[model samples]
Target: MTGEPSSMFEAIYAGAEAGEAKPPWDYGAPRPQLVEWAEARDLAGGGREALVVGCGYGADAEFLALLGFRTTGFDFAPTAIAAARRMYPASKVNYLVADVLDLPRKWQRRFDLVVESLTVQSMPPEQHTAAAQNIAALVAPEGTLLVLATTRDEGSEVKGPPWPLTRAELEEFASGGLILRGVERIESGTWWRAELSRGAGGSTSHARQF
Candidate 1:
């Protein structure tokens, strides 16, 4: 990670300047799994507060906003946030530039639903735990955290950027007073999706559909 862009912001900013499409996990659309979850839970018109982590081009944030959630999308890259705002000019989602590891203190426990898609795996392996802790800190007392990331078997060999997380690593997000409600494998087992709840009193309502 030396000499090369060590942080996501640097990498993405360079990619954007180079006119690359999908820079890193852009996917060009909202995640289908998220759509399914939203539909299953009838999130539309629900008016819940939502936060989108590393909200690349705002697709996921826009989706949540369209569903009546007051969505806020943040990314470490200024270019990414700018592009997201431009891509969805008519959207109500608030797009901002912010680091996942050191988010605004006021944002702690501020959202009812925190959506993290591929954001955790984008960081260096050494930073994964800190990223997870920061992510968990964003959930409200009774909020839900939805995590979607690439997965690898324990002790698997690592390649390059987009290091895949193991099941145990994903479950570790439940630390810091959060509880793991459910874990599912999606995209033909290439991905690990988990639902965690904060202070839900053992209720699995948000994860029951999975």
Candidate 2:
């Protein structure tokens, strides 16, 4: 994973600098699955601190902000961060260019709600543990983390910069006292959304939705 994760995304977003092209996952709107979660009030972040990992173009972060969360979205790619700011002029989200492998210490266990969607799978399998741990570390005590990602059956083969995570890989995020509440497999098992929580506190009200 040496230099691969950071460079791959930064390069892809760089190609979209013209505004005519956007990363394949950037649909110009918040992801529908995430929107549904918010609309259902499954994720209620009223004035809570929220962090959006690998928030390319800021759609999800903006959506969380509108949900009344103090949201911060970050991408390792500078181009993506800049484009997000341009796209959401006067947005409440704090868009930043920061690395997942090396986040600021102040951010450790600082978010009441952390959203990680398809970001960990961007790295190679060798780095999945590190990526998951870093992401899990952002959840404050009793806080919740939502992970939405493409999934593949264990031992299945795939070729991708954005590789689909195996269940084993996804479970890595539950380390360090994080509880794996439930996992919802969607779209014929090709996609999954998982909910997790930290500390002795209970999971989110929508834990059953997972």
Candidate 3:
């Protein structure tokens, strides 16, 4: 079972259930960084598996299905999952209400591609590494992981339920034998897009669920 809801994010989308605005991060479209990366690499899933962590409203998840992936996108917030299903009733993407902190055992190292954008930053700094580990653990052998986040200097101060991540924090995604392949700062260093890959047959047993 998934853990408890993210009260902050839950409240935000809960407002949407009452006909209020979606949270700022819900772009109603796929993440541009992910599209660019996939397009440039000529990445095509061709029925391969993909997972999107903290998939708020299912935009990225639906986008992957268009590229031929058997995609599963999940969010901790029940409201968010409901919104996704409501938004894309005919979509092939599987939208689930699941928490990154508590994933199913069958998911370990099971996805050919994993896309995670902005989800880690929504969590507090204390949970960053654990979130990273779980996200990384979902990648299959020889598969790839893509991560995007709002960027900030390590010592920078900001008032937030959405704390922008530092470079070191982004690096934490290379867990359980996943290699940090490349990293780029975009929009004048205000955003981070990172690509990581796991060596085929490497162990993902180091990952833990809490």
Candidate 4:
């Protein structure tokens, strides 16, 4: 973690410039744990809009749209955005190319379900707070933020575009006024699903069939 690049932005941009195809992060299918969690929680039907960060290829965004949420998928890579638009055309999903740190301020408090699947941890360690804050800002008061990402095992070093988070790191990322509601592991525990609400109030939880 220490000697790794101080930020992922540079690497992402370099990949874009070099036209790197099939970045390891683009796993073809929507991450299963994320898909399963979203389907099970009825999060896609939540009243407000949803924003999918690091939406490479947009399989997750399409899935979210199919579940009835107005979805906005954004990535810094134009190639990825183009691919996403092509893949999800005629669907009600909006795909754009943008940096997560510089999103329009108007988007603040704009979403009910904010999906941060495999995104935050992809940034360098220095970016965790900013990523967390940005995700938190997008959640409307009384909205939910669903997080699905890989976590580092105990005593492991963090070096990555997929910089895995430890449970403590995950908790810290969600610390800015968002309360954790539920947690579950996926695929032999390589990934995790966490549902968080903006404030402390309704603790009720249930899964929705997709």
- Pick the TM-score winner: 3
Maximum-lDDT candidate: 3
Q: Superposing all C-alpha atoms, what RMSD in Å does each candidate have to the true structure?
A: 2.9, 3.1, 4.7, 4.4
Candidate 4, residues 1-210, lDDT tens digits: the string is 234433344455457548764466667878777776765655546434778888878988888887778889998767678767877668788998877778888988777778888777877777877887788777766678788888688678866666887787677645556667777777688887777777423322332212
TM-score of 4: 0.80
Model 1 lowest lDDT segment of ten: 201-210
Residue runs of model 3 more than 4 Å from their true location after superposition? 1-5, 203-210
Model 1 spans with C-alpha error above 4 angstroms = 1-14, 200-210
**Clash pairs detected, candidate 4:** 40-207, 40-208
TM-scores, one per candidate: 0.89, 0.90, 0.92, 0.80
lDDT of 3 by residue, 1-210 (tens): 233338878888999889898688888799888888888878788899999999999999999999999999999988899989998999999999998899998999999889999998988878999999999989888788989999989899877668888999999998889888889998788899988887667654332110
Candidate 3 collision pairs: none
Which is the winner by lDDT between candidate 3 and candidate 4?
3
Residue 3, candidate 3: C-alpha displacement in angstroms: 16
Global lDDT scores for all candidate models:
0.82, 0.84, 0.87, 0.72
lDDT of 3 at 43: 74
Lowest lDDT 10-mer window, candidate 3?
A: 201-210
